[model samples]
Target chain A: GESVGLHLPTLSVQEGDNSIINCAYSNSASDYFIWYKQESGKGPQFIIDIRSNMDKRQGQRVTVLLNKTVKHLSLQIAATQPGDSAVYFCAETRMSGGGADGLTFGKGTHLIIQP
Target chain B: DAMVIQNPRYQVTQFGKPVTLSCSQTLNHNVMYWYQQKSSQAPKLLFHYYDKDFNNEADTPDNFQSRRPNTSFCFLDIRSPGLGDAAMYLCATSRGGLAGPRGFFGPGTRLTVL
Candidate 1:
């Protein structure tokens, strides 16, 4: 909650290199974690998600790792491209009463792709 | 094919004036949410509508109100805009339940308070 309107930390990676963005969530009760890529002037786009039962999940070019023990989540981007330049947010949610709950987001990391 | 569309990608309103932002989803998601995102910051959920049930975040300002007349469309109204209210307003939808699908977000509307 302290992250409101705060300047995001940045991670700069050379183009075609792999980039890893890390987030440390606050709630241990959070069971669902997601990574979102938000380009300038656009809304947040869902990248990859992993549930608590599994420690790892892979998407097309992205992989999400969850560590419930440390309440940590990370996103690994392979062959980072210029288009991949954006702000990355790691969000956690607690599913209760079998329904949707609001997501609590991290301060976020701005991933910059260098030529 | 556009799944979720938000009108007036850029909106300019005078302070103390009432303005409304709109969102419609073709994904037919059961839950729709409105979020306020400031520059270079994470989004904060204002409220959400699960089907016909309206749920407002406790901290959401009383000036902010939402209406989900039907399943596909939702509206966010600001009674009196202030300079601090200027930010990107995002509309998101999800298939809510035990399965809890990832939310689909629309191209946010950037509101500029004059």
Candidate 2:
């Protein structure tokens, strides 16, 4: 089955440095992608999203880069902070006709910040 | 603030016992979704309701069922829970169509089977 997957299961970065998380998706028909952050004992919180039509999108200190040709996506966070420690997941889904469908999430990458 | 709310953040049930988890949303979205997530894994979609129409996943188990009696409330019922069924159940809501649709998730309910 077509699925989204992450390149790394865990990442360790020092505070005040930049961090990057990578994801790859096999579904070419997917038109929308989102990045979510989940803290321990909490549900995922929306961070940013990018549509297939666009190549990149930025929000605050985070930037999402989408490469449709290679079916790859990456999230970069500048000046990583302690609060940035959490599990990050990338989800993809294609719109069904005029309605919507559930998102398919990747395995997720655990980002650990070193103080 | 308008958001999705799930009740009983933690629930404990015995094996083969029936349990129900509740979800409510103040966003008044047209679609509600139920997902199950185990430790160190991604969330798996079980089913969703678009308005009054119910859409179930092909691989969803028969022991799992959902009910949405109104626009604001939805429930997930597990008929015969087993040890493997212990996981975090998340409820999310979204407005239908292709206008930048995004799911708003609740805190989730952690179910434990004894």
TM-score leader: 2
Candidate 2's DockQ is 0.71
Give the winner by lDDT: 2
Between which residue pairs do clashes occur in model 1?
none
Interface RMSD of 1: 1.3
- lDDT of all the models against the reference? 0.87, 0.94
Query: Across residues A1-115, which tens digit of lDDT does each residue of candidate 2 receive?
Result: 9999999999999999999999999999999999999998898999999989899999999999999999999999999999999999999987763445888999999999999
Per-residue lDDT for B1-114 in model 1, tens only? 758899999999999999999999998889999999998778988989989988898899999999999999999999999999999999999888976847789999999999
Instruction: Name the runs in model 1 displaced over 4 angstroms.
Output: A1-8
> Per-residue lDDT of A1-115 in model 1, one digit per residue for the tens?
4321213398999999999988887676777878899988898999988888999999998999987787778899999999999999888776772557777678789999999
10 residues in a row with least lDDT, candidate 2 chain B: B94-103
* B1-114: candidate 2 lDDT, tens digit per residue: 999999989999999999999999999999999999998899999999988999899999999999999999999999999999999999999897866457889999999999
What is the TM-score (0 to 1) of chain A in model 2?
0.97
What docking class should model 1 receive?
medium
DockQ comparisons of all candidates to the true complex: 0.71, 0.71
